[model samples]
Target chain A: MTSQLFSHDVQHTLDIAGIFVFALSGGLLAVRKNLDIFGIAMLAEATGLGGGVLRDLIIGAVPPAAFTDIGYFITPLAAAVVVFFLHPEVERINWTVQSLDALGLGLFAVTGTAKAHDYGLGAVASVALGVATAVGGGVIRDVLANEVPSLLRWDREIYAVPALAAAILVAVLIAAHALGPVTGTGAALVAFALRMLALRYGWR
Target chain B: MTSQLFSHDVQHTLDIAGIFVFALSGGLLAVRKNLDIFGIAMLAEATGLGGGVLRDLIIGAVPPAAFTDIGYFITPLAAAVVVFFLHPEVERINWTVQSLDALGLGLFAVTGTAKAHDYGLGAVASVALGVATAVGGGVIRDVLANEVPSLLRWDREIYAVPALAAAILVAVLIAAHALGPVTGTGAALVAFALRMLALRYGWR
Candidate 1:
């Protein structure tokens, strides 16, 4: 169970990347909702960091990394700007946005699970927190937009399930002392593939 | 500056009362939204404990009191049950509910501010967290119900302001070495009266 499979720098980079992708999705939603620039920025920040904030809080991490890291705080605003300028073009490329969102979900699920484990939570709680970290932001965004959370809707695609699967697999691998870059990648890939498959097949 | 003005038993009782009142509001909303029993219970719990959970997380308190204390966990469910059975009557007494809600808000704001101070946060942060603890649950509840949060709506009566006032007062009193049961009670009453006044006059 090597916790340092990826150096801190690499992990931080990936985290930011995930946040950016998630923020883009949130920003696009704000645009669709016809919210003003401030709303777009607000939603982007919430959607990008909500899950991580929730995870950090549950794990007793004070002043969450999202609040402390200037980079993390600014990435969502950058995503909002990009969306504000290119929303029409971005809307046309819905498939691409969704694919990246799936990638973000997978990455966050793995990372969140690992962090929970680092905080000494048991496997079940780690997996639950991982799923929350992956989907919580979207739930918050949808709620703020006065829409039912897609993750909680029966008719929606199987979003949380893939994240849950990834988290569980990661927890199991860690428990078996086989967790490393390969297994981590494997876990994320499994979740990403499942999400993509759900999109393609209209899985509910 | 005495943190022990109220005995632990009394404080616990007050906490449960606050949770009960908040949960009642959530449950009433669930009934109005035509949600099922499960939804009512879920919203009840969310409204009752969301703020405290959020506050605990920010202050690095693990497994917040909501998760650890059986009373906290059950009080919301009890409120849900009462609403499920007597919603028609509850709806008729809307004024009563609103008054109690104001009391809960004031109580939570004071307690939250004091707790934040206990956690060594400065005055500003403590006050901010106090307001969050007072209104965060209702925001979560409104969001889950797919409505613009009353706290964020410009047309609504002032809600957050009273909580903020109470929190600031509590923080100031604590800093001045003048904090005690009297000051705390006075702060809460000021907030409660302000809220009730806002309700009566439709203050936005």
Candidate 2:
């Protein structure tokens, strides 16, 4: 409400960027599952947009942006196409994909929080939605691929924590009327760093 | 509209009844998974409400009835309790549960389609939403429980087919100006009978 977090343009671009990387992960998983092309695309779209779509539905944003925005809808399909032909190469670059995925998680957590806040959800609910938005795609991907949600499995290294923390931080910043582009970027970076560190050190 | 399909009251009641049976399936799966009470409750709610929630979101019904209606929200919790305390007994009555589940599928298919139509969707989209509402919970339950969705598994008896057929029939009835309580009942009965026959005759 004050100066805002990310500019509308930056947020839109980042959202699409996040979808691209997340869809890559999903499409790669479909390859591992030996699914057909349709299956690969299904996983791509679900993994890329499931989180945001779920948040929008819960917060009363009808006809979610995934349906309305051609870019958002098409980016994941493009990723699917990329993986359809280059899965072996994509698989070879797993670390790079993971790094990009971490960035997507961070960006989505903060942006999703801001959007949920804009929709008038309370702080706790907003943070919850933010964390959900960050982790939802992966959960959907795993579920569709017939695996337990890695995000929820206790044996898995911590994943949702970083998003949760980032969302909480964003909520606090909002409460203080101190959320702006700089703080938002810092917040996202905090999430990214937490996720990378968790991966490296094997948190939980 | 030519005098419509169902009274809102009947639709509301049938919707809750469907939630009860679907939630039972979810609760049973959670028990099989050895999940704790919280997991049981989570699966129950997800299974009971996931489909309707998905449809509502797509059709622009914000804060879906699952959240707004206390009955819709609590019925699944009640189902979880039934499964929690009497799982062994419930399992013993598996055929009964399956039969009731088939009935729920039929009811939800018609009701979900009708609701989607009321929201001003086209016939195709309405039927699709109806089918989603009928099958959505089981998909979520299976996904959450980390198993392949039975509805999508080729080896399983034809599950989604019945719902799809019912929804299509409802759409036809709507188009023909013949959808009233009598025809609506006939459509739901058609779905239920088809599902039962499929299970009985090993249709897949």
Candidate 3:
């Protein structure tokens, strides 16, 4: 029971970290769009929780974890507050933001797939949800900002592709009865490397 | 049991009609935005179902009726096909579209509120979700087209306000144990008239 509890804590910690980075990116976008504090907070909350909310909703998880947990609810606001006060510094560290975003993407993609599988979805559906979980928040952010989502742009560098690969890896592992911590880590690492490489090469 | 079944059928039919009109508006927006055929279909689907999908997710309704019902899935595509072929005619009939949209909004707001009440959401949250069900699709449509949602624009005439009023009325009725077909229809009519008045008088 203690071992199980420890694993649960680790998962929760990772989930919160991913949400923070995603929220930071969202808050930064709100700043760039010249949105007021309310808008910044709204965008941050949406970006951090939108994907998971979507996933949970589709899987019949009511009230959503974000709504139930005060910590989850407040973390994105904290990110938004930081962006509101230090946007210029945030902008200056674009590389750091991008790196964090990549990490979030990798983590979400695998976790989303695993959760979908737990919910009894097929591999294809799980993969789709996984990608949605990874990128859905950004789509919501861009939409609220009245801009084309970078994910759907023809000229945008590869983003969803790497996430898709990670989701697929997790799904395949589950199918082969080989899903475990090592494989999950390997899947995330692969997606992270691909995202970083795409960023470095300006892959379109 | 038979009466309950009959009311359910009536509600279902009304919901489908609302979705059709909403989908038509989404398809028209895609055409105006110069998106391709695929984009048109996607936008149509998103606009038609986005609200209910969000509502269902929040209420813990799994798989979403939109995904489960074949008619719901196909209606938007059909609307997209029509818009693609007769966009000029659709443009010419913009007033008709607007009127239908108003009708759809009223119907959706009341139905959404009732559904939320059935799902055990409190009055305040139910009213919020009701407005969301009425306006969420259009917001998604605008966002995908890279435009500010007219519903959120300060200059735009009243849209969500009338829906909110209707939703509030439903909540009050539910609270008073007076919710019925008469009250529901009356609420919708009130909202519908308000919307039309706003359009005609250019209410800001």
Candidate 4:
């Protein structure tokens, strides 16, 4: 394993950031559901961490990060706490939540692809897993919260597509040995832009 | 690939039955989320069939049942339709939903274990996967619905544990070559009884 390819602190930061956004979405959905604080926290954690845990387990990554890292597990709890108190205000800023969601989706795609590649999977499989991981949490969240998953609906606003693009971008960068901060930023930027445009245009 | 184990019609029936219950749960949650019909159907499909699709993919079961058998996909949609029209009646019978949910959990666990055994995994791994398969959809459903999964919560009745027992029972029967209808039904009954008792006692 190349040190430059996978930095623990870097990955941890990205995962934490992703968890924050996912938990935010989950919390907001709980507000929509009119659930109590406990329900809100539960939803946030499940949405923020469930997909990555599933992906890692399927790939035989032991002690899935959610179990291993207290920080990753607690991030969603913190998010839930914030949302529990500020739910109405949070709902008032739906646009900001949506934007953060897009950013998180992009970051997760890149990180998921990187992790899959580290497990010696081929580029195609890695990218596919990345896409699955990026959206899988929301898919689960929507199903539990009883909304249609934005990714699977015919009216989806390019959710999975952006993840797909981000994964492909990461895989290409890795293949070309050009996956430094510049390319990483470019990949995240591309995914964010695509998702935002999709939202603005109501693209399905 | 044993000819004796291939029961296409039975599998079809079970799939549909499972879809009915699963989609009901998902659709009910969607109603809770206040999503539209499209969102309800989307969640219904995800919660109803996503686990099986995921299991098949992991086991390298090509094309997957969702693709090969139209019924597998259609069942969830049908279920969504039913719930869309009859949610009030269904909601009134919460206990019935819980009972049926336990049944679905038991059946899925057994089937998941059998499938994993067919894929040549060890007993421990197969049982774990079985538990995952049985509860994964519900977990996803909770996350999407923005609620804490009843299974993961400390206060709810024991859910996944009974499914785990059922899977272990089925695995033992299969190993002993005594997994006829009698044994299968016996094991399922045990699971159902355990779940019911737990509910009655408010066991966590």
Give the Cα error of residue B52 in candidate 4, in Å. 6.6
TM-score of each: 0.63, 0.62, 0.62, 0.58
DockQ winner among the candidates?
3
> What is the clash tally of candidate 4?
11
- Report the C-alpha lDDT of model 3 over B2-56, residue by residue, as the tens digit: 1131287788887888888899999888777666665577688789988988888
Report lDDT (CA) for all predictions: 0.87, 0.87, 0.84, 0.78
Select the stronger candidate by TM-score from 2 and 4: 2
User: How close to the true structure is residue A179 of candidate 1, measured as C-alpha lDDT?
Assistant: 84
Put down candidate 3 lDDT per residue, A1-204, tens digits, no spaces: 111212677778878988999999999888888889899999999999999998887866667788998889999999999899999998899899889889889889988888877776667767767888898888888877777777755466788888989999988988887877777878888898999999899886
Greater-TM-score candidate between 1 and 4: 1
Candidate 3: regions farther than 4 A off? A1-6, A35-42, A81-86, B1-45, B55-60, B66-139, B146-204
Candidate 2 displacement at residue A3 in angstroms: 10
RMSD of each: 6.1, 6.3, 6.4, 9.0
Which scores better on TM-score, 2 or 3? 2
Error of 4 at A61 (Å): 0.9
Isolated chain B TM-score per model: 0.97, 0.97, 0.95, 0.92
Worst 10 residues of 2 chain A by lDDT: A148-157
Candidate 3 or 4, higher lDDT?
3
Off by over 4 Å in 2: A1-50, A57-114, A120-131, A144-146, A151-204, B1-4, B62-64, B67-71, B122-125, B144-146
Q: Second chain of candidate 3: TM-score? A: 0.95
